[model samples]
Structures are given as structure tokens and as C-alpha cells.
Target: MTSPNAAQVPTIKSALKFFKVTSYITGIFLILIMVLWAIRLIWSADVWIGGPDGLIALAQFSVDPSTGEKVGLPGPQIPNDFTTVSLIIHGWLYVAYLFGDFRLWTLLRWSFLRFLVIALGGVIPFLSFFTERYYSKVAEADLKKVA
Candidate 1:
């Protein structure tokens, strides 16, 4: 005895639930990555200037590239370079988070302004954790009413 629109309700509800879960998980991961980035940035003052790997320099004992004499230039600081991999992974995950936001927002027919506000949760460090809790409560309440 369900109308066509009623049939669609479950699908939409499920999608929203998924987004809420995903948003929480991805948000947590992004927060952790941001923490790692901060640690690396604060600690890498001297060598962390070049890039994620710091600056690449020839060893002090190595020959110069242009000249034939033994010389050295800054090279990637040992494991600091490894942080580049984390940076790339976080970037891609954030993109995926955006898609999850789109799906949930589209299904719920949320206003663009609200969507933008929610999207900010991903970038502003620990904001995601707060936003995720707030949205989970909202979604749960709304679902309860529907049921």
C-alpha cells in the first residue's frame, strides 16, 4: 500500500545514513592526517623548507653536479619525505568525502548554503568531528520521525 514516493523514501533514507557514517569515518581520518601534517611542519623548520620531503641536497661528501669536486647540497631528510605519500592520500580522500556529501545532500534536498557549511567540516581541522556528531543526531532524529 505504498505510493511511488513512499517507495523512494527507504532508498533516500539509507543513502543519508550511509553518508552520515562515511562522513564520520573520513572526517576522523582527515583530522588525523592534519595532525600528522602539523607535527611535520612544526618540526621540519630547517630541512622541511623544500617540499614534503624537505629539500633534496647532495651529500657533503658527494661530488658536485656541475663541477667534479666533492661537494654536498641538502638532500631529502630521511623519513620526512615519506609524509608526501600521506599528503596525496589525504587529498584523494577529501575528494571522495565531497562526493559523499553530494550524494547525501542531493537525496535530502538540502540547501546549497547548508551543503557548503557541511563541506567546510572536512577542511577546518577538527571541525569534522563536531559536525559529524551534530549531523548524526539530526539524521537520527529525522529518521525516527519517518519511521
Candidate 2:
């Protein structure tokens, strides 16, 4: 008769696949958020205002007709929609990553501390790539031994 453990091989394989995919996705989102954050920080001071001519004009000093001196008023800056969207997307993806982490952690019967470490992979930029690689190898080896 086949051993009971043999029946679990497929399940473990599927879980491994799921965890790997989620790790890559979460890592990608983390990178995207970092890029967006950088862009927002660099260009945050540039402002656009409604010009006297009824057109949008970048906030800059204009020569006064009489005084022959540069003078300009600060205008309302446009919102950074891209940064906002990036934050929202990353937040949701992290949640999904957590779910994936929980699944693989439970399946592997790892300790709670290990689970927390895997979850951190989603938050720390570039860490997910290494974590995923390490965990993938470890899980595969463990599963092979079980099989």
C-alpha cells in the first residue's frame, strides 16, 4: 500500500508554486512603489497656477510691466495621483502577499517567527527576491525528502 505521506506530495508542490508566484508579484509592487516615491519627492516643489490669461502656467517669476521686476504668486500644485495609486496598489498586493506567506508557512509547519520573516519580504525592497529564492530551494528540498 502507498504511504499516507505520498498523497501529500502534490499538495506541497502546489503550495510551493503559489508561494513563489506571490513573492515575485509582491516584490515587483514594492519596487514600483519605491520608484514612484522617488519621483514624487524630486518634483514635489514644482507648482502650476492659473495664469492671468486664463491658462495654466508654471509658478515662476514674471517681469512686472511697470516695476520691471520679477514677481509671481505661488499657485496650487497638482496632486500626485500616480504616487497615490502606487501606494494603494502596493498596499493591496502586500495583503495578498501576506495571505500567500501564511499559506506556505502553515503548509510547511514553520514557526511563527519564520512566518513574520517571510511577511517582511513584502515590505523591504529587494529582500523579497532573496527570500523567495532561499525559501523556494528550502521548500523544494524539504518536500523532496517528504516524498
Candidate 3:
């Protein structure tokens, strides 16, 4: 039979791995959402369809009589499907990331303020990458002491 202490060790190690993986995944999702949102914002300005009237301007296509080549309009607005999907996925990823942060923080018995800082990593761009590295190192060292 495994001792209580030995059982706890594996649980703690597994928790740490969970935190590490989720942090990376959350960070990636946040970056993707930010990029997609920016593109959507920029593209919105060029959209031909606008106003309550609807279909402000139909997509203009013309045939070049000289060459008989059909030419498409420039800056045709595309749908925001990518942006919408990224936003939704990132929201869910942030929730998972928070769960990971909570588990590690409580296990380590870190301060509540520290927990807040770790949580912010998901919302702030580029913060998750740095925070994950720092948190992992500190948690590992603390776990070594406990083990």
C-alpha cells in the first residue's frame, strides 16, 4: 500500500503539470483572439454593406472589354467568423486557465494578491508567457520542499 505522503506527491506533481499545460494553451488563445479582433476592427471600416438601409453598395464587378477579363472589387469585406470563434474559444480557455491557477496557488498556499496577478496573465497580452515561467519555477521549488 502506498503511504499517504507518497500519494500526495503524485497528486501535487500532476496538478503542476496541469497548470503548466493550461497556462500555455490559454496564452496562445489570448494571442490569437487579439490578432483576430484587430483584423476585424480594421476590416469593418471597409465593409460595403452598412447602415439601416442595407446593402449600402453591392460588390462591384466589371468586365474589361479590352481583355474580356472579370475584375473583382478591392477591399471586399469578409465575415467575422474567425474573430467570433477565437473570442469564444479564448473565453473558455481563460476559464480553464483560471482553474489551473487556482489549483496551483492553493496547493502552494500563495497570497491572494499573487493569485490575482496570475489570473491577470490570461487577460493581458504576453503576460501569461512570463507568468507561467515564473510560477512554474517557484511552484517546483516549493513542491520540492514539501516532497
Which has the greatest TM-score?
Answer: 2
Candidate 3 per-residue C-alpha lDDT over 61-124 given as tens digits, one digit per residue, 9 for 90 to 100? 4567899743554432344234445667889989989998898776667889989999999999
**Count of clashing pairs, candidate 2:** 0
Candidate 2 residue 44 Cα shift, in angstroms, is 1.4
Evaluated at residue 60, the lDDT of candidate 2 is 43
- Report how far residue 57 has shifted in candidate 1, in Å: 18
What do the candidate models score in CA lDDT, each in turn? 0.60, 0.70, 0.71
Distance (Å) between predicted and true CA of 115, model 2?
A: 0.6
TM-score: model 3 vs. ground truth: 0.69
Error of 2 at 85 (Å): 1.3
Query: What C-alpha lDDT, on a 0 to 100 scale, does residue 123 get in candidate 2?
Result: 95
Candidate with the greatest lDDT versus the true structure? 3
| TM-score, one value per model | 0.62, 0.70, 0.69
**Candidate 2 per-residue lDDT over residues 45-95, each given as its tens digit:** 223334353444334445578987435535322332344456677888888
